[model samples]
Target: MITIWGRLNSHNVKKVAWAAIEMGIEHRRIDMGGAFGFTDDYLAMNPNRLIPTIEDDSVPGGFSLWESNAILRYLADAHAPHLRPEAPAERAQGDKWMDWQFTFAEAQRTAFQGIVRQGKDVNDPQVSASIAATIKLAERFDAALGQTPFLAGKAFGIADIPMGVYAYTFFTLPFERPSLPNMEDWYAGLTARPGYASQVMIPLS
Candidate 1:
């Protein structure tokens, strides 16, 4: 069985676990990050000291992987290549949005931290600015979803997982959010998926 190390509350870790569940991969998860501290052995596998590291004993030499997206790709390549686009150009279309989440997160992080973690003054100039930027990012996603049924086009794939996790936090937050019908519909579709509902749609802690 594959071994996964991370806390369920982590968004990055949720992505990995969601993928594993969606693919019906047999694995065991260890509660390891955040309040659950990592051991010295954990540090050896991932020097970055991040959550959601995985050990796949099935691979030659017993592969250990770090980085949630890398783990997503590895699982797809190893078990379900159908989860990714077959053509290079099509794959790139999916890749662009998957890569875009980090940049999007940088814009959204301050407001999320302020609103969810610290309960900072929502009207603070910095917080308001961050919220505006995050809305703009969502508008971009809304526009993209208008064209394709999924981020990777017609089919659900790795591209959807990152934003899928973010959408839960974004929509449920108490902040005033602009209504993007297309984005809402897309998110509704995600909520219907068993993997997304159980793994990605948990209460953001």
Candidate 2:
């Protein structure tokens, strides 16, 4: 069995947990970040002090991994090869989007923190600016989705996991957003998945 250490509310953590569930991997999760605080041992495993670190005892000597996207790749490689495509070119279609999610996150960070964490008004200049910037970046996803049903091509894969986690926050934020029909359709399909519905589509923290 593998041990996943992180709180459910964390978007990064959610990616790990949701992938584990989607791939039918046997694992246990412990809330360790945010209000739960981190232990020295946790820091030893991930000096970066981030959430969603995993320790897989299934390996001969045991293996510890960090970085949410890296963990998703590892999980796909080790336990669920089907989650990722085998052909390099086919896989890159999804791989690029995995990295792109970080950009999307950065674009929205200010708005997310201001409104969700700081309880600032949407009209706050900085918050509004961040939201606008985030929306602009989202157009890329909208355009990509228009060509493929999923970011990872015609099917959902590792690539979809990262953005799927963020889409919940983007759509739920208390602000009007320009219509992105393709993204909306993709998000609706995500909600239909049991793993996404249970893990990613939760009350935002």
Candidate 3:
């Protein structure tokens, strides 16, 4: 069985856990990190000491993987081929959005940390600036969704996973957001999936 180590509330852990469920892969998730506290045992598996590390004993040599996106790509390539496009060119489209989500998260750190973490009010200048920046990127995502039903094309793939996690946080926050029909529609579809609803659509901490 695949063993996953991370707290459920973590966005990164949700990516791996969500993919495993979607692929119908049996996994044992050991809660660690956050308030659970990291141990030396966990450190050996991932020197970086991050959440969402996976130990795949099914592999020939036994494998440990880190980085949420890397784990998603690995799970898709190994167990769920449908989650990734078959052709290289087609797969690159999914890769593009996956990478873009990382960039998006970094860009959103200011706002996320301020509003979500620090519990800043709307009047705070830092919160205001961060919100503006985040909305600007959301507009870009909306424009992209207008052209394709999914980030990777017509079908849902790994590309949609990360953003789906973030969308929950974005929409849940008490902020005035501009209406983006296409993005909202795509998110609605994601919410309809049991895997997404159980994993990605959880209450953000």
Candidate 4:
């Protein structure tokens, strides 16, 4: 059996769970690393002390693993390699979008929380700078999506998985968002996916 350890509320954890569902990888999920708190046995599973650690007993070598993105890659290549992309150029392009999500969208989230989630006025010079960054990043992505339906190209794939989860945070943030028609449209389509809705889109706490 495959055992997954993580708080379901975590976005990174959600990504892995979402992929598992899409690929139909049956596994048991354990509650830990949040309100459950970590125990020594949990430490045995992941020294990093992060949510989203998994132990797989069914694989050839039978090992455990951590790191959400790596888990996504593993599951994709193992069961749904089509989503992972076989062509070198397509894979490289997919890698770029994945990196862009972390480098651009995820990085700006701290600012999003400060101004949007915390319900502070986003007009202060510092807040404006941060919001501006988000807007600029969104625009860049809008331009990209204007060309392709998914970050990895026409097909929804591994790269879209991470980026799609990040969009949930953007949609839920409490502030006036810049015009991002393409992004909004893409996110809407993402919401239509059963995997996305099942693993993400729970009520915000």
In order of appearance, the predictions have TM-scores of 0.96, 0.97, 0.95, 0.89
The 0-to-1 C-alpha lDDT of every candidate, in the order given, reads 0.88, 0.91, 0.86, 0.80
| Whole-model alpha-carbon lDDT for candidate 1 | 0.88
Tens-digit lDDT track of model 4 for 36-107: 899899898788889898877878888788988888888887778889878888888888887777766555
lDDT of 1 at 13: 94
* Prediction RMSDs, each to the true structure: 1.2, 0.9, 1.2, 2.2
lDDT of 3: 0.86
Kindly give the number of clashing pairs for every candidate: 0, 0, 0, 0
Model 1 quality (TM-score): 0.96
**Consecutive 10-residue window with the lowest summed lDDT within model 1:** 166-175
Model 3, residue 65: distance off in Å is 0.4
Q: After superposing candidate 1, which stretches have Cα over 4 Å from the reference? A: none
TM-score leader: 2
Candidate 3 backbone clash number: 0
Candidate 2 ranges beyond 4 A from true positions = none
Higher-scoring candidate on TM-score, 1 or 4: 1
Candidate 2 displacement at residue 148 in angstroms: 0.9
Pick the lDDT winner.
2
